[model samples]
Target: MLKALSLFTGIGGLDFGFEAAGFTTIAAVEANTTVAATIRLNRKWDVLETNLDPRRAVDICSSTIIKDAGPLDIVIAGPPCQPFSKAAYWREDGASGLDDPRSRTLNAFLQVIALTRPKAFLLENVPGFAARGHSGGLDRVLTGITRVNSTFGSRYRVHWAKLNSADYGVPQIRERVFLVGAEDGRDFIFPNPTHRNASGTDDDVRLPLYTTCWDAIGDIPSSSDDSLRMKGKWAGLLPSIPEGENYLWHTNRGGGMPLFGWRTRYWTFLLKLAKDRPSWTIQSQSGSASGPFHWSNRRLSATELFRLQTFPQNVKCDASRSEMQRMVGNAVPSLLAEVLACEIKKQFFGAKLDTSKSPTLAVPKSETAPRRTAVRPVPPAFHELVGTHADHPGTGLGPGAAAGARAKRDALRKFKAA
Candidate 1:
């Protein structure tokens, strides 16, 4: 069996996927106590409970004592990505650009690959890692890895692409960048997309339909956990908002007098699932107000979020609700990881590509049907207004509608000031 090493192993998502693809995990490294505990519970591999802090060098051979594991076939790591995350960039108070200490984790990952001399390595990170501003960092990583491969007398080829988890049958629209390198100098090709957008009109019917939010969590009964309830004045307002819609639906043009304009709020602000579409990206840390609300108009429970993240149903994660949320959100969706692992096995390990056993979900045919009966009714005036606006374009409200919305917003402001 091929042996693998996992770095920055958060609850073993990548490890689980590679194992499912027929690789044996020999050792894994993780820093978080809660996450490491979860990994220890689930996996029998050597779990190195130490931080992969980039400021200090990691002597994986001596420190983790993995030198005796024999030749490792692959190394997989997901370095901390806060340095290049869009959310992190948005939250920054000033224009410091792309410099972040967390980015050094990438260097630490390369150092491991250098020391272990694995046959191949896979690095996963947020889509922003490939952004124009971070291209210099990416170049440095590439150069560093090349130097390491040369020192070991192996010619390695590297390839990278941004992939959406939903394309691989995970019921969430999470886009991440994956970089794969091989010591054999063979360039890695990404797996063909197994699923397509629900609204796409491609002629190939053999390609599966994209998994939807309902496909993942439709069968799970609603949770009575207090953690699943939305709070504050907006709690009641959410159920009345339409599925796939956000707080913008309650703005003045939509028959409510909220001060915020359409598109002014974050996508997850009052976000609710549309049965037909994939769920929005599950956040790492969500408060009572942060939501991708259930179509039933409550916050999603940890179990439901796990389902969306493609973790096995029986996999129990023992942690506080908030910590569990962070683990799930930070994880690479197992289905996506599995798809990549299967391809890696075929390309590098001589394993036959097997589509017959790929994971799949049978989405309901009626997913796109109106969900009016699912939640409390909105006021008649607001309902009528929203019904008309829903037909516009781009969630039924386009540029022309934006102009009218702005006018209404200004008028409402005047009325409120009076």
Candidate 2:
């Protein structure tokens, strides 16, 4: 079996995925003690409870990992992605990508490649990591890998793709950028999507139907935990939002109240799952009003979240509800990982895998979704909030963008003054 080293090993999604595909993770690195403990709870891989962005230095950090796990056949990392996420774009100062100090983790990941000289490396991040103007970090990564080739006299070539988890039958429509490369200069081919939209609109018939929410969690027993109850002022509004709809449902353009403007709120606001459709992306940092809520008008239970991410059923999370969400939300879908790992083993390591077999972690198909619930009328209390509200002007022209520009000007002024 090929040996692997895991970085930013949140909830063991990537590790579990690769393991299912015949790679053994010898050691895993994670920054959060709570999250690391959760990983240790399930697996026997040596858990290094240290931040990858080391206080010592990048080279020193790599040395410690090497000392703990020894030489590696591969290094896999999902660096902190906030620096390149959509939330970062809406921040007061706008998205900084690599300029954000947190992005040092990306450099640290590359440095480990230079030091360990793994036969292959895989890096995962939010799609914004490879966005045209926001992809400075990607350039740095390619250049750094090239340097690793020149220094070690290895022929490393990189290939990347933005893949959706649903395309691989993971039951969620989460998109992430995956970059993979090997020391032999062999161009890695990303797997063709094995699933396509189940919605009968498309003519493509070569692939299986997309795994849906019901497919993933329809069989799991519902939890009665009070913690799963929706909270906050907007909690009551969730039921009125139809299945697979969000705050947009209450906007002027929708079937309900004109309580909001088009494109004014974040996409996940009061979002609820439809039994028949695949889920939207699960978010790591969710507000009380943020969603992808159960069609039953409640927050998803831990097991449900895990199933949607295609994590094994027996894996236990010992953390609080919010922390559990953060760890699981940040995870790469295990099914997606398994798909990539199988391809990697075949292409890079010459390992034999039955290409015709489905990923072991893929959720089973369910023939029927639960009956849709009735949409409730807007509560009388919220009727007062209905009125004419302006739609967001456009990207970089919205109110948030104006605020970001002002904040930038103030920062520059302060810097000049100092």
Candidate 3:
């Protein structure tokens, strides 16, 4: 079996996928104590629960990790990506890129690659890692690899692409950037997408339909957990929103009453899942009004979340509801990881599987979708938010953005007065 080392191994989602694809993860490094404990409970791999930032700690060096894990065929890491994720853009000052201290893990990951000199290494991050303005994080990674090549006289070539999990038959529409490098200069080709939009025309009939939420969790037994029930002032409004829609459904342009302006709210606010469509990306942290709620007008159960991410059935999460959601929501869909691992094995390690065959991890399609839930009338309590609402102006002009601008101006005025 190909031996693997995992870093930032959040609940071992990526590691589990690699294991499914025939790699044996020898050790997993995670900084979160609860998350690391979850991995130890489920898998036999050694769990190192320590801060891995090389700039802060000399005790946890790449040499020490190498000495303990022995020879490794692959080093897989999904370093903390908050510094380069879209969520950062919503902050008052905007995305911090590499400036966020959390981003130090990027260097820590590259250090392991330089020292271990594994045959290949894989890194995963949000799409913003390589965005036009946020390319600093990616530049540092490529530069680190180049320096390693010069110092060690090795030919490590890198390839990277942003992939949506739904395109590979996972039931969620999560997009993430994946980077893979081979020490021997072997070329790595990303796997071709095996599924297409369910609404595709007959002209491109060969590809399978995108896997839908119904396919993943339609048959799941309803949970008794009351925490799964939608709460807050907007709870009653969810049944008014149709499947595959959000708060926008009640906007002036929508089929329902004009309760909101177009693009005024976060996309996930009051969002409800359509049985036939793939799920929206699961948020790592969501408030009471955050959604992609089940069509039953409630929150998705933990089992449903696992199915949408295609986590193997045997793995059990022993945490409370909120923590379970946090860990699961942050995971890379395991099926997507399996798809990439298969390609890496074939292209980098010369595995002899036929290129044309479908991946074993693809979620099976269901024969038919269930009946749509009945829509309820918008509650009278929310009637006050309706009428004459202005749509959000473009980016940097929304209410949140306007509020941030005012705060900045106020600070500047105070500074000038002083």
Q: How well is each residue in 120-173 modelled by candidate 3, as lDDT tens digits?
A: 999999999999877888898999899999999989888999999998999999
What value does the lDDT take at residue 412 in candidate 1? 65
Query: How far does residue 123 in candidate 3 sit from its true spot (Å)?
Result: 0.6
Write the residue-wise lDDT of candidate 2 on 279-394 in tens digits: 99999978999988999899999889999999977899999988999998899999999999999998999988876777889787887887888899899989998999999898
Tens-digit lDDT track of model 1 for 216-242: 777777677776778875676677777
Worst 10 residues of 1 by lDDT: 89-98
TM-score per candidate, chains pooled: 0.84, 0.95, 0.93
Clashes of 3: 0
Clashing pairs in 1: 393-396
lDDT at residue 371 of model 2 (Cα atoms):
84
**Candidate ranking (TM-score, best to worst):** 2, 3, 1
Better of 1 and 2 by TM-score: 2
Which stretches in model 3 have alpha-carbon errors above 4 Å? 56-65, 93-95, 201-203, 354-358, 402-418
Stretches of model 1 off by over 4 angstroms after superposition? 54-57, 63-65, 93-98, 203-205, 252-259, 360-418
Please give the RMSD to the true structure for each candidate, in Å. Answer: 8.4, 1.9, 2.7
